[model samples]
Target: MSLLRQLWIMVITITLLAFAGSFAVSMLTARNYLEQQLYVQSADNAAALALSMSQQSKDDATAQLMVTALFDSGHFELVRYTDVAGRVVVERANHAMPEGVPVWFMRLFPIHVGAGQAEVSDGWHQAGRVTVLAHSRYAYLSLWAGAFRLLIWILAAGLLAGIVMQLLFRWVRRPIVQMVDQAEAISERRFITITEPRVIELRQVVRAMNTMVARVKTMFAEQAARIEALRSEANRDPLTQLANRNFFMGRLAQALENEEFAPSGCLLLLRIRDLAGINRRLGRERADQFLQFVAGKLASLSADRHDWLLARLNGADFGLLAPGLSADEAPAFARELLENLAELRRIEITDESDLGTFGIAAYRHGDALSTVLTRADQALAQAEETSNAVVLLSDSDTQATLVAHDWHTLLTGALTGEDFLVASFPVLDRNDRLLHRELMLRLCQPDGRLLTAGAFMPHASRLGLMPVLDLETVRLGLVELGRVSYPLAINLSSTSIADSGFVDRLVSLLRQHRDQAGRLWFEVNEFGFRDELRALAAFGERVRPYGCKIGIEHFGRHFGSIPQLYDLQLDYLKIDGSFIQGIDEHPGNQQLIKAIVGIAEGNDMLTIAEGVHDDGEWLVLAELGVQGWTGPAATGRLQG
Candidate 1:
C-alpha cells in the first residue's frame, strides 16, 4: 500500500479512539453530577415532608394524605412515613421509565442514585422516619442530550481535521512523485533533475539527485569530446581542419553506392598555380599562410551547405563534393569559388591575377572514382591550357538533366497517383536473428521504372512536399505492418518533423493504428537531426505513449553532438557507412566504432552498423559490440 493510505488509516483510528475516550469521560462525569443533585434533592424533600407530617396530625388518613401530596408534588419515586415502633403508617410510590432517550444509551450509561431518609420531629420528640427518593428520568434525558451534542461537535471537528490532513498529504506527494520520475529517467539513461521541495528531508534527497545528474552530464560531455577529437585526428586535415583525402574519397564512394544518396552531383577541384614558384618567391611560411587563407575561404563559402563535403586533397589542391548540384548550376558554383579565390589577388597575397585554376566534373551514381578523377583532371588540363579560371566536363549520356520544374511536376504527379513503393531490408543481430526491417521508399515513374528516394527527395525538399511524401510513407508502412508479424522502421525527413501539422497527423495515424504503433520505428538522418533536435524531441514526446521508437541514422558524422543526446532517450544509432567500410583493415575506424558502441550502450541505445558490405566487415562490427547491422552482407545472409 501507499504511504498516503497508511497515514489515512492511522488518522481515522486516532480520531475514533479520541471520540470514544471523550464520550466515555463526559458521560461518566455528567452521570456523577446528576446523581449527586438527585441525592441532595431527595434528602431535602424527605426532611421537609417528614417535618410537615409531624406538624400535622399523625393519624393514618392525615399521614397518607401528606405522603401522597409530597410524592406527587416533589417528583419523588417514593415517600413513606413509619411509627416509633418501626411500623409503616402511610406510603406513596411512583415508578415510570425515562422517555425520549434511546434504550441502548441508557444501557451503556445508566444513571444510579440513593434514596434520602430523615426523622420527623414534634416538640423535640422523634416521630416515624420519612424516606423519599428522587426520579432519574429527567437526569437520563439530560445526559442523553449532552452526549448527542458532544458527538455532533466531535464529528464536525474530525471532518475539518481530515480535510486539512488531505491537503498536507497532497502537498507532500507532489515532490515525491517528481523525485520518482527523476529516478526513472536516470534509469533510462535520460538524466533529469527535480526541484527541491520545502520538506527538509525530501529537499536533501532531490538535491543529491540533481548533483548526481550534473556530474553524469559532465562525464558524458568529456567522453564525447574525447571521441570527437579521435574522429578529427583520423579524418580531418591537420592544417586546413577540413576532411583529409582518404576520408573524402570514402565518403564520395559511399554517396555513389548508397541508394539514399542523390543519383548525380558535381565535384570541384582547385589547385594553386605553381606552388613551388610561389614558395621560391615568397617564404615557405608566407606560402603556407596563403594556402590556409584559401582553405578558410572555402570553408566559409560552404558553411551553410551541410550536404557538401570540403576536403584538402593534397599540398596545394582542395576538393569540394556538392551532391545534388545539377550541371546547369555547376558554372555558377565554380564562379563563386573563383570569386572567393580572387580575394587572394585583390589583397595582393599573390601578384598573379590567376592564383589558382578550377576543374569541375559532374558525376552520376555507379561512376568509377578513377574515371571521375580522370575527368576532373582533363578539365584541369583544359583550364590550364586555355588560361581560363574554371572548366566543366560532363558525360551527357549518363547524367539526367532534370530541371527544378520537371522534378516538381514529377513528384507532384507521383504523390497524387500514390505511386510509391516501400522496399524492406533486414537488419540482423550477431546470432542472425532479425531485429527489424528498414524501409526505403521508391517513386514509380510513368515508364514503369522505379526511382529511389535519393533521385527525387532533394527536389521534394526544395518544393516543400516532404510532409505529404513522409506522411504517405508512414501510412504505407502502417498498412504493411498489418500484414507482417515483425517490426518495420521508416525514415522521416527533418523538414517533415518540423512541420507541426505533419507531426500531428502522424501521431493521429499512430493512435488509430495502436496495435501496430509499438512495432513502428522512425529514424532521421544525423545531419538533419542535429539541426532539428527540439522538433524531434517534441515528436518523440507525442508518440512515445504509443510505444513508437525514435532513432538516428548515419550517426557517426556528428560525434560532437553525442552529449546532447542525453535528453532524447533514443532507441538506437546507425553508424554512418563511411566508418563501416573496410573496418577489418582499418584499426582507426575500429577504435572509433568501439567508442561509439560504448557510448551508445552507456545510454542504453542499440548500435547498428550501416553498409556492412562483406563478411570481414561484419565480423569486425560484431566483435566491436554492434548489436545489429544492415547492408549487402546482411542481405546476403537473409538470402542464404
Candidate 2:
C-alpha cells in the first residue's frame, strides 16, 4: 500500500478508538449519576413519610392516609407500611423492576451506589421505622440519553474531520502523482519535469527529482552525441556521411517519430551491384574513389531540398525517406536517384552495365519504420536479381493512380458495392502439374475492368488499408474455395502479418471451411517475414492447428537473413523472378540458383522459380534443381 493510504488507515483507527473510549466514559458517568439521584429521592421520600405519620394521632385513619399518600407519591419498585408485629398495613408495588438496561453493558461497566437510609421522628414519639426502595428507571433513561447525545456529537465531529482529512490528503498527494507521472515518462525516454510543490518536504523531493532528471537528460544528450559520432566513424562511407545499417535504423525510427525533422518521406535502400568485381578491376583506391563518387551522386540526385532524408542504410545499401511526395512522384524521383549513380564512372566490366543494384522504395506516413526498411531491402534484392538500374516501388501506375484517387471512398465503395474479386495463378511443377494455385486480388471497377493489386496496392499501403484488404481477400477466397477447391494459396502483404485483426479474420474464415482448410496455403512476402519475424512465428502457430500450409513468396531475394525453417514452419519458397528471368548464360546466376535450391531442399521446403521465360533458362533451372515454375513461357492463365 502507498504511504498516503497507510496514513489514512492510521487516522481512521485512532478516530474510532477515541470515539469508543469517550462512549464508555460517558455511559459509566451517566449511570453513576442516575443511581445517586434515585437513592437520594427514595431516602427523602421515606423520611418525609415517617415524619408525617408520627405527627398524626395514633390509631387515626388520617395519619394512615397521609403515610399511604407519601408512599404512593414515591415511584419505587415496592413501598410498604408495617406494624411492630411485621404485618403489612399498606403496600404499593410496580411491575417487578423491568429490565431497563442491557445485561452485557451493565456487566461490562457496572455502576454501584449505596442505598440511603434516614431516621424520622415526630415531637416525642418515634414513628414506625420507614424503609424505601428507589427505582433506577428515570436515572437509567437520563444516562442513556446523555450518553447517546455524546455519541452523536462524537460521530458528527468524526465525519467533519474525515472530510477535512480527505481533502488535505488529496491536496498533499497531487504533486506526488504528477512527479510519478513525470518519472514514468522519463523512463519511457520522454524528457519531462513537473512543478515543485509548496510543502517544504515535498518541495525538496521535487527539487531533487528535477535535478536528477536534468543530470539524466544531460547524460542522454551526451550519449546521443557520442552515438552519432561513433556512427559517423563506424558506418558512414566517410565521404558521403551516409549511414550504414546500424545508423540507418536508428535515424529512421527518429525520423518517423519527429514531425519537425522529417514530416513525410521515403527511403531508397540500394546496394552496389558487384563491388568485389569493381575493386578487382579498378585498383582498391580507385574503387574506393568510385564508391564515394557514387554515394555523392546518389545524394545529389535522390531528393529535393524541401523534405527528404537520404542515407546509406548499410554496406552498399542506401535508404532515402522522401517526405511530402505522393506515390506518383516517387518513381520519377527514384529514377533520378539511380541514374545519377550511373554517371559515377565508366563501366569497364561490361559496356551495358549499370552502376548499382539500386532498389528504391517509397514510404508515406503511417508505414512502420521497420517495414519500410525491409521492403527497401527486398527491392534491392530484386534490383540485384533483375540487374535493373533501379526498381521503383511506384513504377507501376496502378498503385500510384489509386494512391492519387480517394481511397477511403473507393474502399468503402468496393466493400459496399461488391466490387472486390480474387483470381489465382497456378504455381506449377516442372512438367506442368499444378503444385498449388496462388490467389491474387483484383478490384472490379465501376467501368468493369478487373483491376490488379498493382492498381491499388500503393494506395492501400499508404491508407493503411492492406490489413483490411488482406482480411477481406481471405474471406472472399475462403468463399471461393468452398465453391471450387484447388489447393488454394492466399497472399498476405507485410501489413497483414503483424495485424491481430487480420489473423483473427483469417482464423474465422478457415473455421467456417474446416474441411477445406487443409488444402489451404497462406503466402507472405519475404520482406514481411524478415521485418516481423515474431509476428510471423506467432501467425504460423495460430494457423497450424487448421492444417494450412505457410509459404514465402519472393524468397531468396533477401540473401543475407535466411530465417531458420524450424522457427518458421514454411512449406515452400518462390524464388524471386529476377533470378529466373535470365539464368541460362550467367554462371553467377547458375551458382546462386544452385545455392538457393540447395538451401530449400536442405530445409525440406519445395522451391518454385517465378518468371521463367525461355526453354534454355527453364532447362538450366531444371538442371539446377528448381522444382516449380511460373512465368510467361509457362502455359498458364496469366493476366498481364
Model 1 lDDT per residue over 546-594, tens place: 9988999998764344537878989999998878877798888888889
By summed lDDT, the worst window of 10 consecutive residues in model 1 runs over 556-565
- How many residue pairs clash (N, CA or C atoms closer than 3 angstroms) in each of the candidate models, in the order given? 0, 12
How well does candidate 2 match the true structure in TM-score terms? 0.44
lDDT of each model, Cα atoms only? 0.86, 0.66
> Cα deviation of 172 in candidate 2 (Å)?
55
